[model samples]
Target: MMKLDGVVAFSMTVEAGSISQAAQRLGLAKSVVSERLAELERTLGTTLIQRTTRKLSLTASGETFLPRARRILREAQEATAELAARSGKLSGPLRISAPVGFGVLHLGPALGRFLRDYPEIDLSLELDDSFVDAASGGFDAVLRHGAVGDGRLIARRLAHSRRLLVASPAYLERHGHPGTPGALEQHRALLYSNRTSDWRFTAPGQGWSVIRPRAALRVNNGLIMRDAAIEGLGIALLPSFFIHQALAAGTLVAIDLGVQAEGAELFLTYPKDHGAAAKIRAFGDSLRRSFGSPPYWERVEPAPRAAPI
Candidate 1:
């Protein structure tokens, strides 16, 4: 039988894309991680990784062995967690990924509460807007907005996401309100760097209208785009979570109410292998209970406007 230690070392190295990163995460010396990977390769009779100074890439044989090895390691870890859970103890590090803004605004607080509730579980979180590959990133789960395209990752619905087309009221008053999505083409737009500047709209008893508007400024962060909109730079399409206060205070108004976008969904995704892990299960349950029913964050009543500085 293959050695369990060697299998786990190999999986961690591949997932982290470097022996150094794996060693850091595993709290082992670089030499030890390298030794275990070499040992595993020798036992399997194939080289798993083509290591270079810049990055590590898997060989064909390594690619073939990857999924199975990950599954084996995951199952072993889950069994250990399950045994702990049977004793009313859920203990293990749970790594999570999320977009930077949301991670700071919402997830950070939630994780603090969860950690306090489950003292045995350790938590590590990474924040970025880029799409994360859970298997490669060593994440137990990732909080993602909109739908995920990867079929291998299992997605659990966490909340409903609404996208809004908004601009500062001053900007709207300066430039007349757009009556339809088509009218946006004539206005200055603030767009996200990662996505197209297309806005979709549907009115009651009307068909879909798609608009690909021009952008005056394109930025990578949602917060930046929202700031630009607040400063009267241009109109922006952002997740409703980001603009709740502005919309509620009437600082930023939704231009065409009936012609707004819909169908953007939110999910908490994880590798299919992590489904049975106790920490993952507990956190998922906590998240569902905290935000799933009626989605309190989304249901926030419009707050009164704050005095401008």
Candidate 2:
């Protein structure tokens, strides 16, 4: 019989794409993970994964075995969770993934409180700004802002996210604030993620408008972009949670675009096929409660607007 630990090691390594990453996710040493993978292969009498310097790929046997391995792990986890549920107590390892900025600014404190309430639950959190598939990534839940693009995941709405264009007082002071969408083209655009060379906004009477922003710097991280905007490098479009403190302190000023900027609803998503694990339900409840009925970020004072044209 294959040891569950060995199976877990192999499956986790495949999900994470590397032994080092698997070790990080599993909270085990890299050497320990490697040894377990080697031991598992020895027991199974096959080389499951093709190892290389740049990447790891699954061999024919490994590819065939991956689905079964995941199912086994899920079944074991569900069995354990079922018993914990029967005891009327939530306990077990709950792995989660979240975007970097919102996770740190908002979700981190909320999760801290949840952990306080449930001391027995061990939590592993991965903070990433890039796209992650909760099922493939081995995460029980993912806290996401914007669209939950995958249909395979069940998403529960947590709160609304508001985004807007903003810039430091110093930058606006030197360059002059943009009074219209057309005016934005005159200033430097601090592009984030896929924004690239253009920003699309809804114009009141004219409908959709595209502003081609001159970019001197582009970054994939929201926190870095927020900081860059605050440093007077350029105007940026950012979610409220990311720039609320900066806005309050008058370090960054919101530009009144006369229409909503780009944003989407916040969601806590889990694999639809996995059902509602006790931990996922528990965390989702905590998120909805802590985020408030209107969410804290929405309470920020609105920017002064020039009357409708």
Q: Highest lDDT, which number?
A: 2
lDDT of 2 by residue, 138-177 (tens): 8888888777778788888888877789898888888887
TM-score of 2: 0.69
The local distance difference test score of model 1 is: 0.80
TM-scores across all candidates? Answer: 0.71, 0.69
- Cα lDDT, all candidates: 0.80, 0.83
Looking at model 1, which ten-residue stretch has the lowest summed lDDT? 300-309
Question: Model 2 lDDT vs. the true structure?
Answer: 0.83
In Å, residue 151's CA in model 2 sits off its true spot by 1.9
Tell me, by TM-score, which candidate is best. Answer: 1
Error of 1 at 237 (Å): 1.3
